[model samples]
Target: MARLLRRFAETRPDEIALADEEGVTTWRELDERVDRLAGALLASGLSAGDAIAVHSANRREYFEVMAAAGHIGLRYVLVNWHWAAQELGYVLRDAGVRVLFTDPAFAAQAGEAVEGLDLPTRIAFGDGIPGFLPYEEFLATGPAGEPEPQVMGSPMFYTSGTTGRPKGVSRKRSIVGMPVDVLALAADGFATTFSLPGDARTLLAGPVYHSAQWMFSFMAFMSGSSVVMRRAFDPAETLRLIDEHAITNVHLVPTQFVRLLRLDPAARQDFSGESLAAIWHGAAPCSPQVKRQMIDWLGPVVNEYYGSTEAGVNTIIAAEQWLAKPGSVGRPQPATEIRILDSDGVPVGQGQQGEIWFRYANGDDVEYWGDPDKTASIHRTGGLFTTGDIGYFDEDGYLFLCDRAIDMIISGGVNIYPAEIEHVLITHPAVRDVAVFGIPDDEFGEQVKAAVELVEGIEAAGELPGELMAYCRKSLAGYKVPRSIDFLPELPRTPTGKLYKRLLRAPYWQEASREI
Candidate 1:
């Protein structure tokens, strides 16, 4: 892809490209800003393919920086603002980030992470911070001039690994890497069959750091749709923006959808047929009940896709197909191929539960940034990549997911990614040891549940659950917040101290063990 913004600027210069509460940017304006920002990045000593980490919320600058980086073939590492100092440092160092762009509120926190290292540059947005270059000042150093595009490279996306450390998944989409004919076919199918308009107004409700958010935003931009960006997901504000902007396309995780549905029915009543085009939910499994409710309340416009950062879009459950296969993730997209394999890597027959493996001939392929061994482990000799998710293909060819091959939880359709959550939870003063697992829920499908072993003499304060939840809420998204707390004497573990989450998840599976 030619820097995405460049194509939009050339094709739809006058069209509105981005919209937020602060302001709207036309394609022409966005192109101008990206040019200036790219110049600034170049002036800051960033060369082609050099990594630059961004630690900011969902502001226009976020996309601007991403596009600018793409234009210059500079690697953009979108830092999860929810990460602590240590987590941030690990990613920055691992990615070899030369510069870091962070919000003013997080300047001090980011500073703490880059303390001992010789960081390339640190530019703070919103307000000037001591010892940091202000965003305004950085932009003033370079004039608006289009930077020549370098040879296309892959985008490096770091997966929020729940089991081990986070791994980088790079996706390479060279210039015309995939034929536009295929893209148009897929895009048109999504638009017409799912009721998504080509020029729809979209509001990205979730954090853009994730691959799901980036994919949806990219699809919308490629289709000439206008995006309404949110700094963060607030149910009430999201609803208000939908109404105010007449947003047609809404992409969110199942948790966000649940929250929207939980809003006052009267406020939800304001959303009529024409006001919204389609609601796309993914990143995790959604409850069949929630899907039905969404269809009933909003119309038959709910769509779902099951895929991951490591593996590109594998299967999609369009609205029409969803009614047929209630909990299924539908069939693989046209450009993709999927197979369920047994432990020995042999393909399993239909209706047999096995690991889901995928292959894409034309789309982006999995490229682990620095770990060839990690990359090779997932890819088969034939180029198929195992999703590490246990699912089966029904006779009708729809894919249904079961538990992960690894102990991972999908809370509110956002990957709670247990390891990251556990890492944060273990830092609490009262927590002696902790094991986080996913518990089945009616609305969210699965909720993040933390079973903590409190310190020996510390009396369990009844308010610890609420306090711990509050602490996590401040650092993580609400969906990632642990919904239930269980005080445990000890967590079920192996001799090596690895938690067996299946043992932790057993009690919650009693009532509806095999039901949808």
Candidate 2:
């Protein structure tokens, strides 16, 4: 891959490689920056497999550092900017990060967090910080004439754990690195598959720390596609960039889609343009209604891929197939194998609800950092890692996810997946968002409970608990319906936009215990 980057620099030195609100960077500039950064890292005594933690938001320096790290085989950890000081401290200590690259906005807080720790070095970008190395000074080291090619782990991305503490998943270059052969396939299916004539511009709006953004950004760089990055998600600014740059591809989360759709309808009145060939949505489930509205608003360019930070790319639901399946996540990728297995590890027949397990023929990372026990629990015998998601495959081989296995509610010997009920509840015109969980019940062991966020105007009136209960009773089975409903203005979500159902369940369980 280092050779590939060098080749691109030699072939199209002046071609634009990256663009942001600040300015654009040509391939030559990017290569030069990476070379200088690599030299600086080596001079700082960062050897192969040494961990360098980056604490920043979306920026070109982040990508440059990542490429340089990958080029030299150093493990680059993309830290979550939203994490509290205590959380950051834990991860830094656990990874034994030798160097920390931080954004100036977070310098004060990050400095406080690492005060007593034996951190190797701290380099602050944008706005200088006293007692810390500035980004520009660090990059002035210049290229060290290319070090030995080290093919160590590429990245250590932390998962947004809704159920427990986030786990770091490290993938070695030989394992998680995307092969050149697969680039042709991805290019054919994802970016400019058919035309491939004009220069492709991809808009990256998500945070660089997340796997979804990393995949898109890395793929764009490898494919020689120009990338336009946004500092953060801003609907108006995002739309403006699309119009200005004529972006051909975009990768977004479902939450971003929701906000973008809510922008003044007039903003999209005559928004007819063929520049956007594809819009990839993933990292969390999208409401069926939301998906439909997106298709209607943006034509049929929406595409969804299902996988985790641990497994790079699992399945892809193309536009044509999405129109047919509606809620299906499409079939597994060509090099992957998926199976629906019962609790006993036996494969379930078609249409049976079971845990989803996947294995890659081409080899993939399948463990959590420093937690082999948990890793073993998930990545079971024979290389099949249980996704912990309960779902079934249709006769046509389409995968339909019900809900997380941990989120399932079992009442009086009846198993219920909250997604089945949440799907129905979200369809209600009055309900803006909803989360379903289980609360303890003496009679049934556990009873279904829902926490809902109502649409704006509906909340002005008093509670409509009875009306919502009646609505659910009419459409769902009496046992499957939520036993109680609590309305809230919003639900807690992870940085990646996944609902924190465990937090919602905590209060109900605590109250039940107090009553007992």
Candidate 3:
């Protein structure tokens, strides 16, 4: 097993390996720091499989901790810095996090979350936080040498459950027992498949707490690529970073695409994106209009992948492939089987809408931490499992998602997928963000309803509902247009591009005797 970091350090010592708003770190610097950090984490009494929580925004130290934890055989939980104290505490307790790495910005929430918990180790990066060890000082406590080799560690990410509580997603084929060298080979293969070069530089513009974002950046990092990122995502800054770092790869979501397009013409025009090799997107349904515009402006660098925290990357579509087959999410990756099944669990013919299930040739499966029943519910007779998404394979074998099963509206017995309606509504010039769901109806079991966040400076009131419905009527059937629309100042969306539709739909169903 080759020591990838040390090899990079030995060969290209002065090359930048990581850069954040704080500063830049060279390969040699990063490698030495990781060695010390790995030793410190082990010296702190944490052992293999012990969980450590990182509750900070995107920063270099986050990767340092991740790299150190991986070499020491620990499960590192990437905590959403946006979560409140209660939510943070729930995950901390649930994951049994033995140590916590936080930033000054989130110190208050972290302080409150661990007030009464059994957690004792608390380390803060950047500015000092009360009751927490300074990151630099903590790193100094470990011996300068690299820690002994151990089983590899993996991340345990919590799904942002639209309803109820979030759950930590665990892999059945745990990497805990895998050799670090084997994992690096696999990561390199994955990165290469995405058109990443061995010396690729990746710009992380999204929150790493999301599984896709984590994989895009960290996997490349493991393969010896330098990483450049910022704590928060800014549309103009994102464009600047690409040119500034000569970034070769990046991970983004659909929302970021819309924002990038909305940037002033001057901001968009003064850019050289020649360094970009692949601009990957997923996590939410991207409107064909938005995707096409992106591809037009960025050339064939824009790509898409379909997967979830539970399922991993199942399929991917290149920009050219997407342009030819507009809405398809592409074909399955190697060794992945896609099955669209009807209500009776029978395989549906191609082009027929049904629940999409998957089985991996390597026997990888998803399991929710501490919830056996929840794990069993998503599994089927074979090794197939579902993420509750409804989609179908086209005649050309590309998968197209209709909507999540939970998001489907049954209005007067006619099934309406909100995603289809939302896709049309989002392209409206006046709309910024939108969520379509079902609301209780007297005669009908559910009625299509849309909650829209208007574009900046666009008035939310007036004949907007009628105009939007008229717009939808152009491309969709009468049954698919939202019956009513509500205008909100802002939609409830996470930084990772996931919408909390249940939050908006809950009020409308408070008095109704039904569950969405």
- Name the best candidate (by lDDT): 3
Worst 10 residues of 2 by lDDT: 172-181
Write the candidate numbers in order of decreasing TM-score: 3, 2, 1
CA displacement after TM-score superposition, residue 355 of candidate 2 (Å)? 0.6
RMSD of each: 10.3, 3.2, 1.4
Candidate 1 — worst ten consecutive residues by lDDT sum? 175-184
Best model per TM-score? 3
Tens-place lDDT digits, model 3, residues 272-320:
8999999999999999999999998999999999999999899999999
Instruction: Name model 1 segments beyond 4 Å from true.
Output: 1-15, 150-154, 172-196, 362-364, 408-516
Distance from true location, Cα of 215 in model 2, Å: 0.7
Residue-wise C-alpha lDDT for candidate 2, range 394-421, written one tens digit per residue = 9999998888888888889888888878
lDDT of 2 at 283: 86
Mark the 10 consecutive residues where model 3 has the least summed lDDT. 1-10
| Residue 224 displacement (Å), model 2 | 1.6
State the C-alpha lDDT per candidate. Answer: 0.73, 0.78, 0.90
Clashing pairs in 1: none
TM-score of 3: 0.98
